[model samples]
Target: MRVSGLILPWAFLLATALFAVGLYWALWVAPPDFRQGDGARIMFVHVPAAALSIGVYAVMAAASVTALIWRHPVSDLTAKSCAPVGAAFTLIALITGSIWGKPMWGAWWVWDARLTAELILLFFYLGYMALWNAVEDQTTAARAAAILCCVGSVSALLSKYSVNFWNTLHQPASLSVDKAEHVHDAFYLPLLVMMGAFYAYFMAFLLLGVRKEIRARRIRNLRGALAREAGA
Candidate 1:
């Protein structure tokens, strides 16, 4: 808690700085694409949100695995905290993708493989959170949620690889480590900065959420102890 408290402010500051620079570069500094014109600028926000939507789920799934297998003290809390944030990112990705698609694809949406898979991923996130809320017992809820997270991880895999496995209107990755030349530096650098900002925002939000969960659990435990003493 102490370490997280100290680090949280810096994380927010870093995210803020990166977001300011990234948005400036993406919106103003980067040249309009010859092909898509200014419509392509939306990719700067859309791409990062799309990537993080899956990436955050991966983090939750890993934490869920640890919570289930090793019973790590903070693992379940970490996974629980990740769900809402991941869901928000998924929603952003969907909305932004739709916005970008309408102009480029000439429709608001299509049943593209990647888009369908991403929608399923959003459902998984909602189900995971719903399970946590439905169960009364914390331990039982944690176990059930962890299992769901693991099972739903298949959606994340599908979301990532659907473009590769099937024909789709959605384009391939805008940036790749091996194929750096595919995107011009003007666009690529700003995209990278935006991704960094999103990641930093995730970390800051995750820490804040986990801390809140820990405090809530402590309060519940204390109240339980008080009730037991009164009954005795």
Candidate 2:
């Protein structure tokens, strides 16, 4: 755990550097879309935000499984810490998509399947966080939250496939490793860089959040023990 103390600072610095350069490359270095023009610039942010929102949930679901099966002390904390970050990225995805949509789709939002499913994903995040805090008992709360996280994890798959399942205002994925990338090199390169930066940011912050939760738990236990001793 002491290694985490040393690791977080360097991780934060690396994330910052990557983001700074990635954003610059995305905005300035990458050429605009041949069709959408500068409006396509929003893709650099929207795609990563959307991906990480589901990606973080995937991490949470894995932690949830560990917490349920192995009963690891930190698993619940890891899952709990991920909700807000996932929610924030979900929000960024929604808002950026809306902004990009206004220019392309002539509207800020539509009731299309992918958009609707993403909205549902937001509720799942909010619900998960609320569920954890609403309970007073830590152990009970963690178990409850873990179950909810596991069940709701399906929404991530639904969100990802929604675009593929229906013909909607949203377009299909532009990049795929198995298939030829739809984007040109000018745009694809920067998008790849940005995605890497976004993932780095998530990992760095996630570790920091988990570390804070661990510290907070220890402090609470210490204070409770002191009170019990004084009473005795």
lDDT agreement with native, every candidate? 0.94, 0.89
Expressed as tens digits, the lDDT of each residue in 46-101 for candidate 1 is 99999999999999999999999999989999999999999999999999999999
lDDT of 2: 0.89
Every model's TM-score:
0.98, 0.96
* Model 1: colliding residue pairs: none
Tens-digit per-residue lDDT, 1-232, candidate 2? 7887888888788878878988999888888778999999999999999999989999999999999999999999999889989999999999999999999999999998888888999999999999988998889999999999988887899899888888887898867885474677787778888888888888888888999999989998999999999999
> Which candidate has the highest TM-score of all?
1
Off by over 4 Å in 1: none
The weakest ten consecutive residues by lDDT in model 1 span 173-182
TM-score of decoy 2: 0.96
